[model samples]
Target: MFTSRERSLGKLVVERFRKRRAERINNLMVKEGAYWYDNFITRTSLLEGLSLLIPGLKFGEDVNDFRDLGNSNYRALLRALDKLDDHELQFFKTFINSHFYVCHATNNPAIATKKDMVLFSRRKLIEQDIKFNTYNTAYVDIAGLANDDNVFFSLEIGARPQKTIPGAGGSRFGNTYYKVAYTDPSFDFSSLYLFDQALMDIPQCKISDISEEAKAILNSRKYTRKSICFYGRKSLPALALSIISATRLLPERDRLVLLGCRTEKEKKRTAALSF
Candidate 1:
């Protein structure tokens, strides 16, 4: 038999434990959800930006085709780039830096008589940083899931699965499609308009891909008051731009710091972009 005071103390400990567990779970979910949204936005932005630059360029299908075109028409592309105005050139540069890895290699190293020439190379971008900001963020799935027919149906019928009506062949398996009817008061579907608004005010930058050395230099105490770490090699420019845009959604007192790392092994090599 436990005393009343002892029982009360046990109940308080259990409640505290439950509260801490819930907080941890919520934090994990927010982190995962933020990562998913970041990836989706970054990828979609790349595709949309590419489509604007190169017409008829479709994601997944036309990537190889575009690569071939770039390789075959390398000189022609350079000439075309030279013809672009200042604004157009800046946009093109930003697009390339965000979506591709620009590499430089020196050729004719063996020939003592011949001067070495530098060659420019472009490769697909990879290893984007995981996003950390999750507060007051809104993401709408403009491109919905491919196999969400059943999901929409369930939502329509108050989350209860519906039985298929028997056909002449006796309950033949067939695809059932349902148009999404946004009737849930809990979810604000009106926020979808914000996507279009963001597109209208996209910012352009003069430079992209801040060097690792420069990032390390910025990581010093002299440059940064506080820092938030991020991991990636490519897509830092896009991430920076996204962070800048998201600042409007944050409170004035809340500022963002971008710390870039190529790999987890070099996690100590940090950078900061204070705003």
Candidate 2:
């Protein structure tokens, strides 16, 4: 088992890594003439397909043939993000990319209001902490199951989505997708931590205070302060991590004796593959 502190560190690491990765991908896509809000069919096809795959949003009627979102909430989101600095911009983008899956996963359209998109996107981070035991480890050959009619359903959605041959039960099947990201060197998870909001939001002025407090707590239990990373979640990735690693603030490490728990959950639903 790992401690909460350790788990938090691990999560922060992964969160930071993914954020950098997203920024890199975004820049690359832009360089290749891909914009997120553009009407370019092949470019925005992923979001378009998502709108179709999800239950609430209709193809043409609800979202203008998946080209334009009918709701003003997306515009509102753009406005909100427009005010952020580059550093905060990357952070927000990374944060949203991590939870954008939830937007489509919603079951109720009336309840799946535009506000719900942001709400679920923000809440999914905490939900991740409670659900999984993240580790600085790597996994290979990972596969999971999902249903065709479902939105980001878990791996245990039962049966294959479609059958290769026309048969009696072919219509009742679900889809089994492999975790290809795991195999990708760029999506490495070897140093990921159990994530929490605090790790992402902590301020620098409070770092020394927290470090002192942590030391006192550990000393009472015969533990010593080791190294600590005062990143506070704005840290950029290194060259080995991604091409955009140098775009953000560098990570800081401190020595402190941190304690936490490493929890383990059943391997029920595997990685989410909405592609």
Candidate 3:
């Protein structure tokens, strides 16, 4: 019923709309896949990636570490990593160094107790004349550290609760339950190395170094939904560092929240402290 010119214009509009729709669908799929990879598959992928990067590394003796073999998610992460160019790989390394923490707890009689006891940073270990075995380390994200409520609880109890342990089969290694703990606050802050070089340590801040400005920023309704990236030997110092770093690293619009703690005392301590 339309003129030829009108019909041509209608067809062009339809084509453009279809193209945009397709792009939107594709983007959605990509995002969903990324979410799956990050949440469900990243732990296995990280272990596998470390195995690939390090020639003779073994997670545990007499255990098949790659039990998640044939998993589609596992394969997908490896494929993605394999496709990265040198520059991309370097960027990935930088990202990992910035966002991840290496937890080194052990049951080795020479180094630590029969049950895993949380130790200080590498610098602290050296200062105390303790020898560490790097082969028996676990890599975890900083965000995970901020989210775990039981870190202090496990330390207080001297054993990780059964429910909180990583796998259903119980501790992976013999007599050693790997868990992160809140480090001692009394240690020298100058020597404290919470994370890699990408994250700078606040050399002078103690457990109670939080500023009023930082507290206000966190309490603001605008930032209520933001996830805080904590860094410190103890809770308040961690909170303070996260607030300080967020000003530079995170976007202005994002919120910053603290991780969970076990005790009312710890909570009260954090609440009472201000700089």
For model 2, residues 182-211, the per-residue Cα lDDT tens digits are 223333312111111111222112223124
Alpha carbon lDDT at 104, candidate 2: 19
List model 3 lDDT by residue over 1-275, tens digit each.
99999999987787667445434432332232221122323235344344324433432322111112112223433443345444334433332223212232334432355663544443345577867553332332112111111111122222333332336533333344443433332221111212221122222322333454544543332211111212122333333333333333323332122222224443333322211
Model 3 deviation from native, Cα RMSD in Å: 24.1
Off by over 4 Å in 1: 34-275
For TM-score, candidate 2 versus 3, the one ahead is 3
Off-target runs (Cα >4 Å) in candidate 3 are 1-104, 109-134, 137-186, 194-239, 247-253, 256-275
Quote the positional error of residue 102 for candidate 1 in Å.
55
Highest lDDT: give the candidate number: 3
Superposition error at 164 for model 1 (Å): 15
Q: Which ten residues in a row have the lowest lDDT in candidate 2?
A: 140-149
For candidate 3, the per-residue lDDT at 230 reads: 21
Evaluated with TM-score, which candidate comes out highest? 3
Q: For candidate 1, lDDT tens digit of each residue in 62-93?
A: 11221222233333334433454443344334
Candidates' TM-scores? 0.18, 0.21, 0.22
How good is model 1 by TM-score?
Answer: 0.18
Q: What is the lDDT of residue 61 in candidate 3?
A: 23
